[model samples]
Target: MSTRTETDSMGAIEVPSKAYWGAQTQRSKENFAIGHQPMPLAVVHALAHIKKAAARVNANLGELPTDIAQLIEQAADEVIAGELDQHFPLTVWQTGSGTQTNMNVNEVIAGRANEISGQTRGGKSPVHPNDHVNRAQSSNDCFPTAMHIAVLQAVTLHLTPAIKTLRDGIDQQAKRYEKLVKTGRTHMMDATPVTFGQELSAFVAQLDYAQTAIDNSLPAVCELAQGGTAVGTGLNSSPGFAEAIAKELAQLTELPLRSAPNKFAALAGHEPLVTLSGAIKTLAVTLMKLANDLRLLGSGPRAGLAEVHLPANEPGSSIMPGKVNPTQCEALSMLACQVIGNDTTISIAASQGHLQLNVFKPVIVHNLLESIELLADGCVNFQKQCIAGMTANEQQMAAHLENGLMLVTALNRHIGYDNAAKIAKKAYEDNQTLRQAALDLGLVTDEQFSQWVRPEDMLQPE
Candidate 1:
């Protein structure tokens, strides 16, 4: 190895001497450097924006001189504009205290701000990172504030649309299959006749509820923890800092951002995050139900329910000569499981908060953001490959309707249900078909039964 003095000849490094963080960042980078699961990128960007926005609000106040205030605001702006993104490299599995992430943000903002003011990176010469940039904040408040922003934006831009796409696909399929009559199965056996459209419409209705829950929960997330500096008391902040910061953030984010109703409550723990995780859990449950339907409808082409045909993305099996599977449904189901697991982790972490601060924020943010990302991705794929491409198998569905012994509802109109039930029981006992039993019983006139017993017409009460 020529070992060209290997002195970082490009000089492409910015060293941080005094970390803006208190202590947690150092220990975390050393402790959980195992997995590749990095912190959410949206979170990193949002944190920088929160810092810059806070600086702008502070600078606007009459307390600070105009020159210094403007300089601080400019530095914070540059970091939000993507200057400090690279320096925030760390895994999500750091200590639950979130000290590492807090420090990572502080160091990056301070270093970038110093560079903007023509000072050396990480220099405290005139503007110390903690003294000036992190003036009246702590990881306790800042992390939760950033987490709120990241989550709100994600639901508005990503999750909402993904869910709508899935819902619309189901609604569309429902319309397409509205006239298609199929035997409805319960307990793994045919029970009644229902239109394919009716089945899909139920799914659409469920997704609607899930979406509504998500939308309603997001506004609560807008309540931020800016002024709740250390332990949620606005202990070290200026008198008007919280309101001013809220105004600045609202202007920057175009959201109705506001201060937490109680600083003490905000700093005590991350209950808002817990609520958000619960919302995600609801969405995951909807996905699980939808996946269950997909698997059931696509159960088998020759030996199973096979009510609807799934879009064949790839060969479904290694051994079966001609097997195509509901892979997209499987993927969505798998992602739903992951989200469920992450929700459990979040719930556990949320409950683990000590007296003053919930040290579990880093893990909470990591798992929550991960769930959001996976759910968004899964919804998009399920819409395109599964719901959008699904086709109604009319012939098979009709055959199932004809084979089902549950079409006795049609005979109920002509003969009373008791007689129809007796006839049906006799048919099942004697291995005779319902149609044959009805003909043998002569309980239903041919003319009366023609309109009554038709599968398509039997979906509605006759």
Candidate 2:
């Protein structure tokens, strides 16, 4: 392949003639071959945003020529639009500070800027990668800034809306099933009575709590490390550079971007990400439990609870005819497990930071973005494939509620707990409904049993 030489502080190296990246990015490509997975597109987009904001801020501050800054900004716009995604080929296992990826963006933007100015791809004249494009910034700050912008944008633009959709879908279903009483279970045994709406409301409440936690965590994530340059002292960066860039980034990304209150702490640890990941982990647990409940409720139309009918999108067994699986619930539950695992990885990565910089940045951002994307997609899929189409087996629910000895819970106020337990045991021993057992044991007349043990009434406190 035809190649061109690009020079950095380390000296000259041959780069692919057609490639947009320079020496450092090419060196990183050759050195870090451990993980083939490319950095996530969200991070790349965020890096583009940061580069553009910095260029605009520098130009405004008279630190860079307006024409050169305009070219860099234009190229970064293209990168943000994903027109040049193929140029970033480095793996996620590179330098802990993500310097390679940062340099990769700088080189690509500079190369594209050079090309736009009628210069060659490897030319470093009017728009040198480090001196011009990466001016007043270090990989130390830019990388974490990119991570913050990416995570906040993802949560605000994708995860929040997806979760809201899920919550709304569940709320609509809850409203629809408000009167569908079923036997509620604890310890996998019948305990009391609850409406189908009440069960679904629990998931809605969980989603609300998760959303609140995520929203509360955003201010910290939006606190950027951009001004910290190499080691939190803002070395080489001009006075007010951090503030200007932060303001420009906020306007550009429309996020609540701010300079970190403590730059050293921001660069040395990713506590904000850790906190957000915890919230996401909680959401995953909620989703897993809800998915399992759906699967259990929809299990075995002929044998198991079968209190609800999941949409039959696929066959459950290869040999068994007319069997449909709860495929969406299965997929959602599996996704939840993966998200939970990713949270653990993020937590560990967050704890691995050294004195000045966190080396685990690539892994942390990658895992965090993966968790966000998985959860967003999972919520959408679960709503589309399962929740939106779920149908209550009203007849089965009524039957279960009528026969459940747990409905005696409502009678505790009238018959006393001891009598209620005795009635339940008597019903189980005789394989009879509690109503019949109460009648046989002279616990109550038919009218009293009907009034006291009504499942619909049992759904609420008397």
Candidate 3:
């Protein structure tokens, strides 16, 4: 492989001639080749924003030359646009503090800035990575700040919209099926009759709660850890450096960003991220329930309780001919499972902090971002491929309603619970429906039976 020598404080190292990274990034890359998955694009974008805003802020404070700052901003903008993505080649396993990835970004932006300034790639003269690009910032502060920015941007751009789409789709289904009465099951056995709209409305409400949870955590997520340069002391940074960076970042990303109120707590803990992860897990739980219920309701066309018909996107079996399956529900269920597992990882990582610095930032950010992306994308796919095309099997639902012995539940309010149970028992013993059994048992006339046990009226008595 083609290589060139670059030097850091640790002295000389060889980097790929084509790579924009420098000595430290190259050394760290060699040290940790554990995972193929690079740090997420959202993270890279957030880092770019951080670097760009830092350069601009430093320049305004007379800490850096304006020309150099403009060049760094230009290069950082390319990174933000994903034009220089191939330049950042470090994995998530490099440094627990994510210092390696931060340096990787710094090196790439410096190299690009150097290129713009008409200098050699590895030469750190005009746009030195640490002195200029990463001025007044430490990996400790920048990484956690980037974590918050990435997650916040991801939730705003993807998760919220996707969840809204799913909730609205469910609401539309509920409105369409407002009058469609179906057998409601408890403990996998027929218990009572409920309108299809009412069942779907429950899922709608769940998504609403999940969305609210995510929304509530946004304020905490907006608090950034950037100002606390090293160990939350803000020692080397100029006064107002943190606040200025926050303002620049907020203006650049169009997000409501702010300086961390307590740099010590921000540097040492990841409470906001943990809270957000919990909210994401809640969404995953709701999704799992929704998907499983859909699968059960659309189980079999010939044998099982096939009340709702899901979109048949794929074949159920390799051998079974002409068998369709709920592929979207399966995908959603699998994603939900993954998100739940990611929450465990995030919680553990969040707790691993030891005073003034959490070394597990990379893992936390990686897992948290993955969870958000999976649920967001999964919701979009499920909504389009499954929910949008789903239909109610009115005939099948009607057949189940007629055959379900639980319909006698409505009669309990009028004819006493004992008589209702007896009528249900008689229907079961004689292999007759409730209507037929009620007529033979002299419980009531046809008109009275119909009036007392109407499924439509059973929905909402008051």
- Candidate 3, residue 22: how far the Cα is off, in Å: 0.2
Location of the lowest summed lDDT over 10 successive residues in candidate 1 = 1-10
Task: Give candidate 1's error at residue 133 in angstroms.
Answer: 0.9
Q: Note each model's CA RMSD in angstroms.
A: 4.4, 1.3, 1.2
Regions of model 2 farther than 4 Å from truth: none
Residue pairs that clash (backbone atoms under 3 angstroms), model 1? 25-99, 25-100, 96-359, 97-359, 232-263
In model 3, the worst 10-residue window by lDDT is 453-462
Off by over 4 Å in 1: 1-28, 31-34, 63-68
- Better model by lDDT: candidate 2 vs candidate 3: 3
The residue-by-residue lDDT of candidate 2 on 1-462, one tens digit each, is 999999888899999999988999999999888867898888888999989998888898889899989999999999999999999998888888899999999999999999988888756777888988899999999999999999998999999999999999999999998887888999999978889999999999999998998888888898999999999999988889999899999999999899998889889999999999998998999899999999999988899999999999888889999878888998999999999999999999999989898889999999999999999999998999899999999999988877788888878888899988899999999899888888898988899988877776766646
Which residue pairs collide in model 2, if any? Answer: none
What is the C-alpha local distance difference test score of each model? 0.75, 0.91, 0.91
Candidate 2, residue 136: how far the Cα is off, in Å: 0.6
Question: What lDDT does candidate 3 reach at residue 115?
Answer: 87
Q: Can you rank all candidates by TM-score, best first?
A: 3, 2, 1
Ranking by lDDT: 3, 2, 1
